[model samples]
Target: MLRIRPRALPVPATVLAWPVAVGSLALAVAALVLHASTVGGLRDTTNLHLADLWLSVLGPTVGAAVVARDRRTGLVLLGTAPIAVGAVAGAYAVWSAEVGGAPGAAAAAWLATWTWVPFFLPALLLPVVLRSGAAARLGAPVAGVLVLIAVFSAFAPGPAGPFAAVPNPLGLAWAPWLGPAAGVLIGLTAVVLVPAAALLAVVRWRRASGDDRWQLGLLAAGEAVFVAAHLSPVTAQPLSDVLVAVGLTALLGSVALGVHLRSVTAGLRRERELLATARETERLRLHRDLHDGVGPELAGLALQLGAVASRTGEPVLRELEGRLREVVGEVRRVVDDLRPAGLDASGLAGALRERARAFSAGDLTCAVEADVPDGLPPAVEVAAFRIAAEALTNAARHAGASTCTVRLGTEPGSLLVEVADDGSGIRADAGPGVGLASMRRRAEELGGTLRVGAGPGGGTVVRAVLPVPR
Candidate 1:
């Protein structure tokens, strides 16, 4: 069953990203063309000609970066939509202004003023995505986007910047009451989103390692430099633009690196899963061979030995038969260890419930709440089951808890397993034992995580987040 496998994307990244990229390239090419045709390209690249350069490659590249990754498809689309829109609007602004009396020039000019908005908004989600692959919610981020649009819609700035000495076509001509709302937006952005983004970046930085660490770190770093350069002296436009260009290039490069790394990691994970599946298949085959092929033969040998022993009263034949019985017991043990008890009859959730039932007693009570779907990858299922079992065992025997709850659920691209017990909490100074270590190993082996610590108020909590193979 392909339940956990992601449906194929209707459009490939190369197909979508390339055309958009080419369009952005056309923007830069157009900016240069219009620049050479007139004087505004180099004289005022930042506002007139240079605005198109920002969108030249960076905007589309940023959009492409998010598009190439399969995770959070809708959010990625929503987050990146502004890039192309801003680019085209900026390009149109340049083209119209060059033609002197070109239609819609005023509107395009006003729209171009906010070309920097799209690049700023995705900052809200970038840190969160780096920390956790999933975006927790869309409400706040969407609201932020709307607020940005509303600010531009409601407030008409004086004749400056992209307005090009002309009134803004989008903003209301004059509205005294709109300032409070705009003030509120600015304050929230500065106080809430900025600090929150910084905090998330720090948290994500601390959590990520190896390629992940550097990739997201480079993104943060590159964007910081770009922002700093944007705020630099206007007199240093040439130097500032260079810094901005480098920073933007770095941003695109980092995302590309991340996508490449994710592809490689996913491929390796699939290979490992295939190998594990093959190994399990072999285990089952060996179990069958021993059960069907060797069992009868061993029984026949025992029967002959017993008959000879009975006829001649030979002690050696009796001893040989006893040894054969021990070998049979060992084989059965191996077969049993190959799979969890009742795992075949009952799925992961059912096995969890049975394990929960086994742990329940007068002194300790166990409960299970599960929401796992069918057709989960076998490796993911086995890992979840084992992690849950170990957690349950710890709760039952070690925690001395009155109540232990096992919760199994699914997150966007992963399985969530949590075991919380209301016994004495894990000691602050105590190190992780073999059980904890084993659970961590299992989760990490599947490209996930396990967290064991004191529960809220009291007792121990075991949390494992395991990636389900797509």
Candidate 2:
């Protein structure tokens, strides 16, 4: 059994990011209402704000705690625990921030910052951190979600309420540091976010297996260039945020495609291997059938023919030799039927001739006509030969036919094989025997149909029509 270690994570680190972000927003809203309102609301707002801060700080700290625990305690203990790193990180981010400023503005700013941390970190490190462990699996989706949140917030209106910057009504502007300060704050936030993401990603990459590391490395490197351009001076912040959203979506799409392609390729390879094995098994089975069934039977016929030759004065000896020769030939023909070997060189006509020679016995006049052209497909040749042989044998044995005629001629866009016998007429509703049923199966296998009905002169005629190969 393959022991897949539960990815190392802190207790309570498994809270999904969306819930964390939503809960943080809810806390901010509650705190803002209390802070902005009268006496009764103020106390409640302070408590909520404090709770938010506690959560944010404790979240990531627990992750480090778990890592420490893993370092000291053992991976086995961690396996028994349900703690996950992402949940902890999300919880930590949710609870850490101070909820002190204006309601709307402070909430937007905090959400933006919190979301940015995971976004930038994962974007920067997911590719690099795909080592041999749990981190690799967690990196891409975590980072992607963070980027998505940031993109959503970028288009939202600026922070309002208590957190809003003081508005200037006069002609002269008062605050010089305000504009540049905001820009610097945004830039610094981005920088800080990148490294934190890298920590998680690098840990993951180190723990990953085989080509997984290479795949993450390639994906992460491309993401880096894209992130740099988004955070750069050349683009609008809003547009850059959108671009990040698009990039993350594309990265996720690529991961999905990669997984799908890998599965499909694996399936195709397995099928091909199975097919080769099947062919080998069939070859072995055919060799055994021919050797066990046909080989001894023909040897017995040869012995009988030798005995007949020794009994010189008897008239029955000549007939016995002829019959034994036919039996030996029939055994060889049945053995050859195991697989179609040389339809290309001998053609359908030659195969039929061999079959006729095989079944020639007393009162069975077998005539085979080979007017049909050579170079017809191998499938057609094999189908034609089997159908003709089956029809001839059925006529000679069951129909008590004195004469059998096999005609092969090419019709317009079709190849026709007609076998007619001059013997007792078939009943109007005669159910097909095993030999005729086999001929029908052979014809159908090659995209053709076989028919057995009354001949004009009180006999049975079997006809098969097959398509000309393209």
Candidate 3:
């Protein structure tokens, strides 16, 4: 089994992040203030911009920086900020032509024409990146798609409302295909991208547990709000942007809480791994000390006592010698219990063969067919060997079996172990026994599975598939 090291993510410095956060907030606030002062403070325009741009764009940007587990995550959260802010501030420039920032307002107006893409696209992506593992990796590509949508919309032939009044400085009137392509992208967003993201969120939510589950739920709700505001004709009403802001706030809060929760979960997992390692190391130390030091010492003392007893003809020394021999036997048992070495030194195949031999005696015979290569990871080897051993033990002890077979093999990314005995089969309704539960735990800990049932030939069979690290 091979361990693949995680690729290190690029982390932006505090200095760089601070500038972006400040600049984004400044632009959003300036737009809101300009819109408010020019259009009346009591009007819908000012209030709508306040809820939409501030929360959807600026709010998540700042929240991610402050609460994200990594700066890279914050970067992802803020990646689409410029586009969203541009669309808002640009619209302000177009509306209030005398608003002083009109010299560059054309581009913002062109951006404003497509109301939904800039803000809603990012919202659609929140759930994917927030999941924080393989999903977090999706942040870049999705952000790339967002960029493409924005860039292509610049040349969209029949631009949205704002584009007709104000020329797109970047618009290409000759490129008719660009409009259709952008439309296709939008179509894809509606048909494929949006549905996929939603499906991914649903799947993750179903699989998630505890706090993570609810965090995803909040995220899903937030995403839904943006989609609602974008698609609905009532988007011009203050309520739309207000709900959008509330949704963005939910998104921001859920992201922070999810990152913190996942971090806690990761920390707890590491602690558990450390504890297991410590316990294993201590057991090995105890095993070695007892086997090498105490066992021989007790045996030597017993021999000396026996000699003394014979030389002096003393019954007391003889009894003491016998007691020492018994103590040595108990020590050997303790040493054996302290550690398992068969699968540790050599590979699982050999260990399993030896185990089968040990269990093969009297009325029963055991056979092994193993196709495993050497140097399987200790965890995989241990799990496979232990499961096979337990299954064989159960068969030999419980089942009146004449013969048993042990099979060890590998499937694409997993190690397979199967033990079958031709004896009275297990009851269909029988619940898991202590041994079965233990085997299941061992397999599950490695993200694997175990199944016990009637063998194809007769009697019972136990099968476990343990994932081998690759």
Candidate 4:
């Protein structure tokens, strides 16, 4: 399989992340302070105070969490918008409420006009949640339009009672033209932009999988609550405030939880990969120990037995010598069974050729065609050699074959080994034996496949493909 590397974050940007996060968090805390002060200290019973505080806290917390994990600039900016805007607006509102001069009047008017800004938080994040460049492209213009509406509504000459159901502190009046224009713009945004964003989110949710699907579903639920509260009659009072709190909480909580879950899944996958690597290393170490240490000792003992047999010619001694020779052969076979020693000396192609030569005997003509490259990974080489050995053994011992062919080759990203025997094919009622299963397991462990069936030449064919690790 081809592997694509992700782009790395630049060094300076990564180093600066913590400072930016702290700054954003500080701004969110400042917003909370202003909210508490304006609502008559910490003892305020108003629902607006509670809603504003919830938003102020949730904004920075969710932003920091997303930035720390994903490090996507777009998402980070979206996540922090609520905290920044709320901080500025809350500070202005608190100053306006405390002082009663000209500056205070202007600040109060601005606060009353732009009270809807906090409600725009989810809409601002719609682009990020939708995960589409086109949505992001369109979001910029839609956001600009919303801003224009806010500016017009704030300065418009009309008797203002409240903005977005929150009581207006400054009974400021607006111009006739400004009020109608702002009202028309707000209506257009609600009619066009909101549905567009919702449709985009739905489409993205349908296309997403795994954790993304869950995240989007939770986000949708939160958005539904937010919208329902905003569209409800003005008499809903505390109910609307409660809905806003629940919706914002659900949105931020879902994002944080999604990020946490994705991180956990990635960590578990890495652990599994590390364990597999350790097992492969240990298997290769045992192979080397047996081949280097035990094989030589057995060979030396065989030679000593040969020398003793030449000097002593008794019948019993000769029989014992014969048995000793058989034992030596069995030891050599056991060493080979533990690991293919030929793989160390030669690569996969050379090792397969050696196995093919060993299998060729009376009534069996084995031909090997190998075109594999050097420097394949050790695991791939071992799996290919073992699979070829097993297939060749089955062909020679079980199949009444006249001729056999072993071919080794490479594709773009994998090594292929095929052992085909021209003999009576496998019986229909025969069960798959351990040797065939072992071959299949080896191939699968290496992220490849092995197929056993009738060959094109009317014989049993066993083909194994092992991926070449990048």
Give all TM-scores, in the order shown: 0.70, 0.30, 0.72, 0.52
Q: Give one digit per residue, the lDDT tens place, for model 2 in 4-99.
A: 898987744334333443454454444444344424322222222231232233223322333322221112112211112222222222233233
lDDT of 2 at 295: 69
Compose the digit string of candidate 3's lDDT tens values, residues 1-470.
Answer: 99999999776555566666666667666666656566533233322354556654564465456434645446555564564466455556545554454465665666564543555444556667665657877766776776687677766665443334455556677876777787787777755776577667767787775446776776666556555544556656566666656656665666666666667766775565455446656776788899889999999999999999999999999999999999999999897666555655556787778888888876889999989877676566666878998988988898989899999888898888999999998977777799999998877666677888887788998988877656
Instruction: Give candidate 3 regions above 4 Å deviation.
Output: 1-15, 40-51, 54-75, 99-102, 107-118, 121-123, 126-148, 157-165, 176-192, 204-236, 341-348, 359-388, 391-433, 436-470
Local accuracy by lDDT, each model: 0.65, 0.52, 0.68, 0.64
lDDT of 4 by residue, 10-77 (tens): 76544554455566557656655655566444213122444555665565556555665655422543
For candidate 1, the per-residue lDDT at 39 reads 53
CA RMSD per model (angstroms)? 6.9, 21.2, 7.0, 10.6
Which has the higher TM-score value, candidate number 1 or candidate number 4? 1
State the weakest 10-residue window (summed lDDT) of model 4. 158-167
Which candidate has the top score in TM-score? 3
Which structure is stronger by TM-score: 2 or 4?
Answer: 4
Q: What is the lDDT of candidate 2?
A: 0.52
